[model samples]
Target: MVSKVTTVAFQGIEAVPVDVQVHVGPGMVAFNVVGLPDKAVGESRERVRAALSASGLALPAKRVTVNLAPADLPKEGSHYDLPIALGVMAAIGAIPAEFLHGYAVLGELGLDGTLAPVAGVLPAAMGASALGKGLICPAASGSEAAWADRDMDILAPRSLIQLANHFKGTQVLSRPVAKLHGNAGPLPDLAEVKGQETARRALEIAAAGGHNLLMTGPPGSGKSMLASRLPSILPPLTPRELLEVSMIASLAGELAEGKLTDRRPFRAPHHSASMAALVGGGLKARPGEVSLA
Candidate 1:
């Protein structure tokens, strides 16, 4: 029998749906994963094997094939671990196949059966909501996913066994609450400036009218200092803006403990930073300092 599970593949900040198909059947005993998986995704077979063994389940002594659908799309990240594992379990009748049909699942699995947090949970949650599906993510990312939609169903399990128990009706898992970062002390205030009255006026006008201000001065002339205090004078981010900012931060893996804050972002890059450092470019094309700001 072939069991299928829903998951996602990230392209930039967007979460594109991917189906995980697992088949356990009569053949030579081997495990294979196909469909344009990157190294991280290819290695999930071992993690899933060990995790299931730790959770008191084992793969059958038959041929097992896992295919990530849309064979042309390149899949990356460790987040596929959970869905692939769950797909295998459902194929072997360890969990009811229908149980996973309603959610978009993404998380990393430890060798000891624990679940590790993965990046892009917020965007994945939003994509799942758009599909009218719920989200199943690591417990550590539950707060971040909760921000997607209040009425959306979410299952934030700590480990493989915990999730299995919940599905079997032996345990009940509650939805995780959204969290906001606590005040990290006070922000710099422009009122404390001893001088630079002209620079301060320019900062205020920039803040009030939402205009860009360019500052140039000799070293230690309070250019950097005045720029640092600009966020303090600016208004707090609106709810919509806060969500947008948090989503960018989430993709960059900069959200501390999956908690978000309302303060406007303040980025200070070194003058000698490279173009890629400022604008973001890498194997995965992750967001850079400017994008985070």
Candidate 2:
């Protein structure tokens, strides 16, 4: 029997759906994963094997084939581990196949059956919500996923055994609450600057009118200091802007403790930063500093 689970592949900040199809059937005893998986995804077989063994379940002594569909999309990241493992579990009847029907799953699996947090959970949660499905992510990332929508169903488990128990009705997994990073005191205020009245006026105008301000001055003339204080003078992000900023930060793995914050981002790239570092273009096309800004 073939059992399927839903997950996502990220393109920039967008989460594209991918189906994990696992088939455990009669054949030579071998495990194979296919469908354009990158190195991290290709290695999920060993991780899944060891995790299941640690959880006291072993792979069936038959041929096992895991296919990530659509055949043309290149899958990346360790986030596929949980979905693939769950697909195999359903295939072997370890968990009821129908139990996974309405959720999207993503997380990395440890050799000892623990679940590790993976990046892009927020975007994946948003994508799952768009599909009218719930989200199953690692416990560490549950707070981040909870920001997708209040009414969306979310199941966050710390390990394979914990999730299995939840599915088997031995334990119940509660939805995680969305978290905000506590304010680390107040931001550096423009009032702290002793001089540079002209520069301060420019900063105020830029903050009030939302216009760009370019600062140029000799070293120790407060150019960098004034720039650092700009966020303090600026208004807090609107709800939509907060989500947009947090999503970019989430995809970049910069959201500390899976918590969001209302403060505007402040990025100061070094003079030696490369084009790709500033603009974001690599083999994976990850979000760059500008996107986080």
Candidate 3:
């Protein structure tokens, strides 16, 4: 019999579904992982083995074959550690296979059986919520997943033993609360400037109209001061805009403590940045500075 666990892969900010299949059956005493996994994923076997051992579970002397489905898609990251471990557990009857049917799991596992936080938990939670499934992630990332949906079912466990205990009804895990950042502390006051009346007026106009501003002047012209104070007069981001900005920041793994903020993002790319850097399309096709700004 095969035990399957659902997880996700990332392409840019999008989360793509991945199936981790584990089978333990009569044959030579061997363990193998298949599918087009990258280096990080290929090495999960050792981590999973050590983690399970730490959790007091031992692999049976049977052929253990794990396959990541959709064989062509490149699987990556140590986040697969949790789901893969869970799949193995389910296959060995250490945990009930039916218990995991409703959830998608992602987390990195420490050799001591602890769950380590990983990037992209927010996006993975969002994907699971969209699919009408619960999410299981590291405890440190619970607050991040909580932002996806207040009603979504989430289980954030600190370790493999803790999660197993929860499933066995020996312990219970609490849902995490979504965290929000307080108001961006005090924007620079526009009144501090003593001169540059023209620049000040232009700044005012741009703030009022939500228009972009480019200040061109020689050194010591108060350009930097004027730009810094612009936020004082600019309106705070609307709720929808705040979420949009937060999503991009989350995808970039920049959201601290999983706290959402109302402050508008301000990005300053280096002058040497190429057009591709500004407009996107590097080897990984990451979001561009222009888009982020």
Cα-based TM-score, every candidate: 0.98, 0.98, 0.89
lDDT of 1 by residue, 1-293 (tens): 99999999998889999999999999999999999999999999999999999999999999999999998999999999999999999999999999999999999999999999999999999999999999999999999999999999999999999999999999999999999999799999999998888898999999999998888878988898989999999999998998899989998888887788999999999999988889998888888888988
Itemize residue pairs with steric clashes in candidate 1. none
Candidate 3 backbone collisions, by pair? none
Task: Give me candidate 3's TM-score against the actual structure.
Answer: 0.89
Give the residue spans of candidate 1 off by over 4 A: none
- In order, the Cα lDDT scores of the candidates are 0.95, 0.93, 0.86
List where candidate 2 sits over 4 angstroms from the true fold: none
Error of 1 at 293 (Å): 0.6
Give a tens-digit lDDT track for model 3, residues 1-293. 79999999888778898999999999999878898888888889899999999999999999989999878888877899999999999999999999999999999999999998887888888899899999999998788889888899999999999999999999999998987777656877999888788888999899889898887988777877788788778777896786667666666667777777777666667779999978876644557887676
Per lDDT, the best of the predicted structures is: 1
- All predictions: root-mean-square deviation over Cα? 0.9, 0.9, 2.4
